[model samples]
Target: MRKPLLMLVLAAALNGLTACASAPSADLGSAPGVKEGSTPSKGSTLIIKDFADRSITFPSAPQKIVALANGEMDIVYALGGTLVGRPTATVPAALQAAQSVEQVGSTHGLDLEKIALLSPDVVLGNHPLNTKDIPGVEGVGSKMVLTSANSIDDIKKQIGLFGQLLQKEDKAKELTQAIDQKLQELKTTPSTAKTRVLMVYGAPGTYMAALNNSLSGDILVSAGGENIAADYPKLDNYPQYAQVNTEKIMKSNPQLIVIMTHGSPEKVKDGFMKEMQQNAAWSSLDAVKNNHIEILPADLFGTNPGTKVVEALDLMSKRLQAAK
Candidate 1:
């Protein structure tokens, strides 16, 4: 079943750093030493340290795998790894051909029974959402590897680590190198104007603003756009994002507004515009007056676009240039 776009957006909004509790450490089980550059031979015992510093051991290279997150699924596909199960969402175009893969819940929840039935050798997931199911996944004899990515550097590291896990280090290196090169090229790309942008995720009534520290905010800054939401105090309720304040937005007068939505981009943008048009304050906003509004692609912006980071960056750069 394809995952709903709104649920995916809400999942991303709730998965920010502040929404999660501190991860508990686990004991490293008996396993062979596997360093950063060490390649694991098939059937060799391999040990991996996850994002939360917990160690997990695999008795052998994982052939049948389950990925509970979009980013993890993307990495698996990018490295030519097969998936026995994937979250019930629209996966990247490259992996759409694997229609036989079973739906294994979503970022908001997991189907432990379905996952166990798959008899996967390894299960990849992230913190908080997958926290409660970690032991259960291990109980089913599947090695659970938790991963995280909040910045460009973290994304690069994850690509390298996933490559290591799949024994596709060469492919991982090539992908990361290409991403680095594209990012570097963007840095030198000349822009005659800089637009203060308000990056948001939500529907009409409910909205959240991305801060400078968030992945989308970081990408916007890298693409030569300024995030106006950065100046406001962080929301205690959502540290990575802020409540949309009309007064603050009016005062800031962002020149461009970028909406990240999971549903039909046209419908979402139209709904938001309709709501804003009802308010005199919103009508006076610079972005509204100049009509500098854009809807970001859900595939690239809704979740952490793993190997597609460069593509996301390129899109943002082009939009920023056009807005100028």
Candidate 2:
């Protein structure tokens, strides 16, 4: 991005920050490792510890950038960084600034050649999903910064990272503070009987439960829903997700079945519903019998919503409240 535009954005953001700063605040908590700009590199280079725990060094701040995930892409644009290339996904309405960015490929199926030709100074991607592309990006002398967002703190960390990268540290602080206040207001209601919810995320054939550590699960818990998959054994390959346990699910007897799909919502939901119908065991669950299943909005829940996190929390809280 040009220095002038960056300056104008930061200046314009002060109005938002001032408005948000007027809100009440409460002390919350945190997580670790990828704190964006936590490390210092040799000489004038900038060193940042990515979510993968790899130290990514860039000579000065990166200008040409590639974003491989919608969430990270959202953060970049929010921080006033324009992308040379981006992944193929629905740009959240709030991130309309990125709607015109060039599409590269999906996270798992990246067009390495196309990305290489863009000659981005740095590439932003999600942990695990985009870590495998480090070689491809590095081969072209570009650095890859990977991050995971399994919780609100993770989202804040992303803002921090992008804010620093875009040279908008003050804006990042204002953003995090605003989010913190909003979250405190959305604190889970204290109830003797919490809503029992089974949070599921995946494509049609391959389904997984969102365990307590995943972002979806975190959102569930934050919204006063008791996650049935909270204590389930984590999958070795995907610690945040677990293999669906029908027996355990039946035993838990959840009141709500919340779904977040990775593909076409209509197709994914149809496939899931078909599976539930074919298997009477799943069909008989209280959540199904009561018709309390809910498929979250794709832009807000399926993947990370980036700066739209507070909105996601508000939506989840309201849904759980109505169900209760």
Question: TM per model?
Answer: 0.84, 0.80
User: Candidate 1 — which residues are off by over 4 angstroms?
Assistant: 1-39, 264-267
- Can you write out model 2's per-residue Cα lDDT over 148-200, one digit (the tens) per residue? 88887899988987776666777888888887887777663466678888888
- 251 in model 1: Cα distance from truth in Å? 1.9
As a TM-score, model 1 comes out at: 0.84
- Model 1, 1-324: lDDT tens digits are 334644543444345333444434444542212454445776687666676566566776689989887778888888888899998887678567555689998757877667766879888887545766666666555667776666777788788777877778789999899888988898787756687899988765567888887788888888889898987677896677888777778888888899998776777788767766666788787777878898898878857888888989999988887666
Q: Give the 10-residue window scoring lowest on summed lDDT in candidate 2.
A: 20-29
TM-score of 2: 0.80
In candidate 2, residue 233 scores what lDDT?
A: 90
Extract clashing residue pairs from model 2.
none
Give each model's whole-structure lDDT: 0.76, 0.75
Q: What is candidate 2's local distance difference test score? A: 0.75
